[model samples]
Target: MTLIHPAEDLGVLRFITAGSVDDGKSTLIGRLLYDSKAVLSDQLSALARAKHKRTAGEDIDLALLTDGLEAEREQGITIDVAYRYFATAKRKFIIADTPGHEQYTRNMVTGASTAHAAIILIDATRVSEVDGRTELLAQTKRHSAIVKLLALPHVIVAINKMDLVDYSEARFDAIRAAYLALAQRLGLQSVRFVPVSALKGDNIVTASERMPWYQDEPLLDVLESLPVGEVSGSAAELRFPVQLVARQDGSHADDFRGYMGRVEAGAISVGQALRVLPAGHRATVAEIIGPRGELAHAHAGQCVTVRLAEDVDISRGDILVAAEATVEPARKLSADLCWFDHEPLSSQRKYILKQTTANVFARVGSVDSVLDVGTLSHGQHKGTLEMNDIGAVQISLQKALVCDTYEQHPATGAFVLIDEATHHTVAAGMIRAFTA
Candidate 1:
C-alpha cells in the first residue's frame, strides 16, 4: 500500500463515484483511502470502534468512513454527497461520493457537474443471468447520461466486486463490452474499464494477483495517468462576471475604481480590451491587482480587481468579456433543465433564475422534450416535468443576460432556478442556445 514516486506537479483531479444503490461507492473510496495510506491511524481505529460490521467476519466496514449522517449509517446508504481528499505520490484526488438512488439523481448531477472524471461502479453479480436475460440497472446508465450531459471528458467504468463473480475474465469482458456501447452512444470521450474488489483492496491502489487477466494498470494508476483537465482554462474565451464594483471604500487608493471578480474563463492582460456585457461598454484593462498586489495579467480561476482605462457602468450582475470573443446577450434562452421540484414545472408559473453573479425573473416559455431515461431518447411531450426529470425548456428572462452554450464554456453556461415562494433551488440548468 505504500506508494513512492516523485511528487506530482499536477492539478488535483476531482472525480465522483456513482452507480445504483449499494454499488459500493463509499466502500470503494474508503478502500482507496486505506490502501493509499491516506487514512489516519485514529480513523482506522474509529472504524473498528463502530459496530456496523459489513459481515460476521472482522472486516471493518469500509463504507462507514464516508456515511457521515446517522440516517445513512442506520440505513447504510449515502443520502448526500460526501467529499473526501487524498493524495498519492503522483497525484492528489478529491472524491465526491454521491448518492446513487433514483430519487437522489440531483445529488449525482450536482457532484458530476464539477468533476473532471466519473468512476461509475457496477456490481458484477448483476451480469450473471438468473433466467434467459439479465436485469440491467437503469441508474448506471442514468449516471453515465448525466456525466455525458455535464461534458466530463474522462470516464472509468469500475466493475466492482469482481471477487463476488469469481474474478472471471468472461464476466468482466461481457460487462465491459455492454458498457462500452452505452458509453459510446452517450458520447463519452475517453473510457476505460478496471475490475476491482473494493472490500478486499484488490486492484484499487495496486494490482491484484488474483485477477491476472486484467493486464492493464490498477485503478489508482489509471486515475493518476489520466490528464488533470482537458485544457488550460486560459485557452478558452475570457469570461469575467463582475461580482463587485470596488468603489466608495475608504482608502488612500480612493481612485481605485475597478471591477472585481474571478475570471471564469480565458485570460486577461493589461491593455486588453474588454466588452461590458449587456451594456456593450468597451474599456481597456489598465491594471490588475491580486491579494498580494499588482499582477501583469490574470487567467481563468484568478480573482483580481481590474482597473479599466475609463469609467464604465458595471454592476454586480454585469459581465466583462474579451472584446474579440464575446457571448450572446438574450432575454430568452433555450436550455436543458433538470427539474428538482416535487411538483411538475408549470409554464405559466414564475421562478428566479440565478446564473453566475446574476439573477433574473424567469418563466418557462415551453417544454420542448423530456429525456426518457429508460430508453435514453428524447420524446416526452408531457406538459410538465416532475422531479428528477430532464428536458429541453424555453425560458424567458425579465432582462437580457450574457451566456454561452454549456458545451462552449461550462462556467457561464450553467445556471439554476429558485422557487419564488419557498426560495429553494428548483432546477439546475445548462444553457443550450439563445431564443429568437
Candidate 2:
C-alpha cells in the first residue's frame, strides 16, 4: 500500500478526460482517485454526506467528487475544468476532468493543451445500434478531433458504464470498433481501449472480475505504463523564451545581467552557443542560475536565470535557441484556433497574440476554413468564427515571431488571442506553419 510522493523523483503524467454529457467522466475520475487510495478520509466523509447525491439507496455518487460547483452538482454537469492530482508507486498523475457539454469545448481545449495523454470516455448505453451500424455522439467526435489537433502522445478510450450493459464484451468491442474508424479518419495513433464501469469501480484501478473475457490491462495500469513527454520529433531542440532580464549595477566590473525564463523545449548547458531572436544576437551561455545556486545546465521545464558570455540586446519577448538550430522569424502565419468568446471572430478586428512571453498585435488575415465536428470535415468559413468554433486561419503580426510548427514543438507553438478592447482571452491557437 505504498504511494509515491509527488516530489519523489517520479515522472508526472498530465492527462485529461473528455466525453459527451453524462458519459460518466466525473464518475470515472472519482473512481480512479477513490479506489487508488488517493482520497482523504475527510473527503470521503464529505462525499458520503453530500446532499446532492445522484445515486439511489444511499449509495455515494462518486461523480460528486469533481462536480464542485453547487450549480453543477444540482444540474449534474461539469462547468469548468476540475484538476485532481494523485501518485502511484510508478508515476504522478495530474488529471483534468473537463466539461463534456459542447459549449464547454474551450475548457476542454484548455485542459488538453498541456496534456501528455487524453482519456475519452464512451457511455456504453449511449451507443445506438442502427441498421447494424453504431453512431457516436457529437461531443465524443468533437473531443476526439481536438485530441488529434493537439497531437496528444497517447489516447485511451474507456468504454464506461459496463455494469449498465451487463459487462457485455460485445458492447465494448462494438464501441471500440466504431471509435477506431473515427480515429483512422482523424489520423490518430497510440490509441488504446478499455472496458470499465466507473460507478461499479470495475477495471479502473484493477482488473474487473466480471469481465473475464477481456484480457487487457486495467485503466490505471495502462496509464502508469505509458511513456510521457515528447516521444518523437524536434522535442530535443532547445527553445527558451526569455521572460525577464535581471540587471544589477554595482560597478562596471560587477555589472550583473541575466536572462531569466523556463527552458521550454530542450536542454541548455554552460558554454553552449545561443541565438537571440528576433534580434538574432549570438552569445555563449556563461552560467545557469537556479534559486538554490548556480548550475551547470538546465533542461526542459526548469526555470532558471541564464547569463550569456557576452552582453546581447535580449528582451522579455525575445527567444533564445541553440545557435545552430534552424528557426525563422515570420510576420505572418497560419494556425488552428479554438474560438472561446461570445463575440464571433472578425477578420478586421485586432487581437493581442501571446505566445510564451511574447505578445504582439495581430489580426486574423483570413478565415481559411471551419471544421464540421459532426461530419469531421472542413467547410469554407462564413466570414466569422463563432463561440466554440474550431478553424484554420491566417494571422498577420505587427512584429516577427520566432516559432515552430505545433507538430514540431508544442511549448513554443501554442498561443492565445486576447481581445484588444476587452482584454479577455478570446481564443487558443496552435501554429500550423509560418506563411510569410
For lDDT, the strongest prediction is 2
Provide the clashing-pair count of each candidate structure: 0, 0
Model 1: how large is the Cα RMSD against the reference? 2.3
Q: Per-residue lDDT for 1-436 in model 1, tens only?
A: 3354555546689999999999999999999988888888898888887876564555678899899998898889999999998887777789999999988988888998899999999999865453644445789888888888788888998999988889989888888877887877777868999999998989998999999888999999998888875333552388889999887665666566888999888888998988888889989999999999999998877899999998888899999888876466888899999888887898888899999999999999899999888778888889778999989999999999888889988988899999998998899999889853
Q: Candidate 1 versus the native: TM-score?
A: 0.95
Instruction: Compute the lDDT for candidate 2.
Output: 0.90
Candidate 2 regions exceeding 4 Å error are 1-10, 230-236, 249-253
Q: Considering every candidate listed, which one attains the maximal TM-score?
A: 2
What are the TM-scores, per candidate, against the unseen true structure? 0.95, 0.96
Q: In model 1, where do residues sit more than 4 Å from their true spots?
A: 1-7, 128-135, 230-236, 248-253
RMSD of each: 2.3, 2.1
Which tens-of-lDDT digit does each residue in 1-436 have in candidate 2? 5666666544889999999999999999999999999888899888889989888876888898899999899999999999999888889899999999988899999999989999999999999887998989999999998999999989999999999989998888899999999999999998999999999989999899999999999999998988876332242388989999999884788899998999888888999988888988899999999989999888888899999989778889899988888787989989999999999998888999999999999999888899898789887668779999899999999989988899888888999999999999999999998954
Among residues 3 or more apart in sequence or in different chains, the pairs in candidate 2 whose N, CA or C atoms overlap within 3 Å are none
Show pairs that collide, candidate 1.
Answer: none
